[model samples]
Target: MADSAESAAVPIISTSTSTSIANVAASPAEDEAIPVQRKSSSPVTDPGTSPGQAAPINSAHEQSEQEDSDDDSALGAGSILSETTSLADEITQYRYEHNRRYHAYKDGEYWGPNDDKQNNQLDIAHHLYLLTLEGRLHLAPIGDNPQNVLDVGTGTGIWAIDFADQYPSAQVIGFDLSPIQPMWVAPNVRFEINDACDPDWGYKKNSFDFIHVRAMYGSVADWPAFYRQALAHLAPGGWFQQIEMSVVPTSDDGTVTEGSIFDMWGKISLEAGDKFGKDLRIHEQIKGYLDDAGFEEVVEKVYKWPIGPWDEDIHMKQIGLWNQLHWEEGIEGWSLALLTRVLGWSYTEVQAYLGKMRTGIRDRKVHAYHIINVVYGRKPIPS
Candidate 1:
C-alpha cells in the first residue's frame, strides 16, 4: 500500500483546463496543483458477463435428490427456493413506485432503488470506480493486512466481497438498508442490514481498522455526524475513506451550456436533495467534514469522470463508455423518488424530464463529466 505522503505526491489528471488535479487545502488560498500524468489505456472486459452455473446438489438418497430436483424444476428458470422467516419477508417487502423498488427497511430514507435493474447499474458503477482508480479497489492506503474492515452502504456487496478475496485475513462487514447481497460470499466477509445514518451503529467503539463509504451523496443527511460516528468506530490510527461523485456535470471547454438539459437536471436534483434534507453536493464538502471530525493526515484526490466516450485520452474514453452505460441505466432510479416525493413532481413529469436528460447524457458533443472525489483521513493516536 502507498503511504499517505506518497499518494498525495502522485499527480492525477485535471478536468479543468489546468494540467493537474490538486489535493484540497485547508483554505482555498493555500491550494496547490500538480502536473497531470497520462496513463496508457488497457483493455477492459465487460462486467455484465454471466456467472458460471452452480454445482448440482449431492444427496446419498436418490429419492431425496429426485424430490429436490422436482421442486427446482417446478420453480422454473431464474428462481430459487428457500425457507423464509417472518423477518426475512418483512425485509424483502419492497415498496414500489414509478416502477422502481426502494428498500423496505428504511423505506423512504435512501433516494435510490434496490431492484435488479438498479443492482446491475450499481455493479456497473463499481466497475467504473475500479477503472477510475486504475484497477485499485480503494485509494485509502489501508495497508496489506487490515484486520477489520467496514463497508457502509454496501449496495450489492461487490466491493466488500472483492476486498475480502484480496485480503483473506481481513474480516469484512458490509452493511446496508437492503438485504440484496448474495448468500454465497467469502468466508471472511458478511453482510448486515442496518441504517448507517442512524446515531447508534450497534458496533463497539474502536472496532474497525478501515471504514469505507462510496456514492452516498444524497443518502446521508448529516455528514459531520456521520464522520464522527466513523471516527468513533475506527481504531486509533485507522483510516476512513469516502468516494462521491458530483451531481453536477461540467465541461472544461464550455460545451455544456447554461439552461441545457444537463444543467437543469443538476439544478433540479440538487434542489430536490435540499428539500429532502440530504445535500447532494457532499463531494465538495467532505474534506472539511473530515478535518472537523478531528481526523488527522486528511487527504483528498479528485478525478474527472467523463459521462460519454468523447475524451481523447484512451484511459478516460474506456471509463466514459462504462460511465455512459451507468448514467443511461441509472437516471430513472436516481430521479423518480427524489423528484416525485421531494420536488413534488408527478411521475409522468419526472419521466418527461428524465427523457431529455437521457439525451443529454448520450450527447458526445457536450463532453460533460462529473467530478469524482476521494477523501480519506486517519484517526489520531493518543500522545
Candidate 2:
C-alpha cells in the first residue's frame, strides 16, 4: 500500500479548465499518455439545463404537492430537529424496490440504497479512498487535535468511526438519511439521521472544528446553499473538506472507446442527475463553491482512480482492484433509482444496461478511470 510520504513525492498535473480532466501524474515512460492541458476560468453550467431555456414553472397544484412532500418526510429538517431517536418505526420503515431496501424517511431523495449489500460497497469505497489518499483519512490541515468533528452523509459511519478511534479525544458525529449504522460504536462517536440539504442542521453556529463530506455528488440539489450551511456550522479557522468523484470515465490510452457501455453509463448518469436536480459533476465545481462560501486558504487535489487492476503502479493497481468491487456491488443500487425514477427507464432495461456496464467495468484492457477531487478550505478567523 502506498503511504502519504510516497504520494506526496509524486508530481501532480494542474489545469484551470472547467471540464473534468485526468490529473494523473506518471513517470517519464508514461509522459505520452498525458494530454495537453486546457486553460479556462468559466464556470460549468448545469448539464440538465440547456442554454437560453427557461426553468420549468410548476403549476399551483404541483408546487403544493412538492411542498407537502418535503414537509411530511421524516427526514425533513423540521421533523429531524424535533425527533429524539432515529429508531422510530417510521424512520426505519424502509421502502422495498427491485430487491433493494431504501430509506423511507426521505424516499426517492437519494438514489443509493441503504441495504447490507450497498453498505458493504460503501465500506469498500471507504477503503479505496484511504488508499487513494495514501492511507490519510483526510487532506485538511486540521491538526492532530480536532475537538468537534462532523461527517455529513456518513454512510455506514465507517469514516467517522475510524476517525474517532484515531483521535480518542475528539467527538465525532456522523449523520445520514438512513440509520443503518451499527449501535456498537466508539465511545466518542455517534450516528444520527438527517439530510444535509435541510435548511437548518440543528447545530450551533461555528461549533464544529472539522467538517468532512464524502461522496455526496447526487444527494444535494443546491451546492451553494449546502456549502454555506457547512461553513456556518464550522468554527472560525476550522476546516471543511469534501471528496467527490466524477461519474465520467476516461482512459489515458484510448481503450475506453466512444459509445461503449462505459461511455453511455457516464452520459446517462449525468442526464439523470440533471433531471434529479443534483449535479453529478460536483467535482468540477467544488473549488468555486468553497471560494464563494468564504473559505480561505482553499486547496484542491485531483487524482485518477482506476476502475480495474490495470495500472502498473502497485499502489494504484491495488486501489483499482478494490474500485472494481465498488462498481460491481454499487452499480445496481446506483442505477435502479436514477434510471427508473429520473430517466423513465424500466427495471428490465436498467438491468440489461447494467449487465453490459458491469462487464465493461471489469475489462482490464480498458484502463478506464474516474477523476476524484479532494477540496478543503479553512473558515477565516475573525479579523
What TM-score do all the candidates reach, one by one? 0.79, 0.79
The pairs that clash in candidate 1 are none
Per-prediction backbone clash count: 0, 0
Tens-place lDDT per residue, model 2, 60-164, is 344565779866665667666556455476688899998899998877789999998888888777766766665677879899988888999998888887787
lDDT of 1 by residue, 53-154 (tens): 222212123345465886657663433324335557878899988778899986798989998888888877777677666567777878998888899999
Candidate 1 global CA lDDT score: 0.76
Regions more than 4 Å wrong, model 2: 1-87
**Against the correct fold, how does model 1 do in TM-score?**
0.79
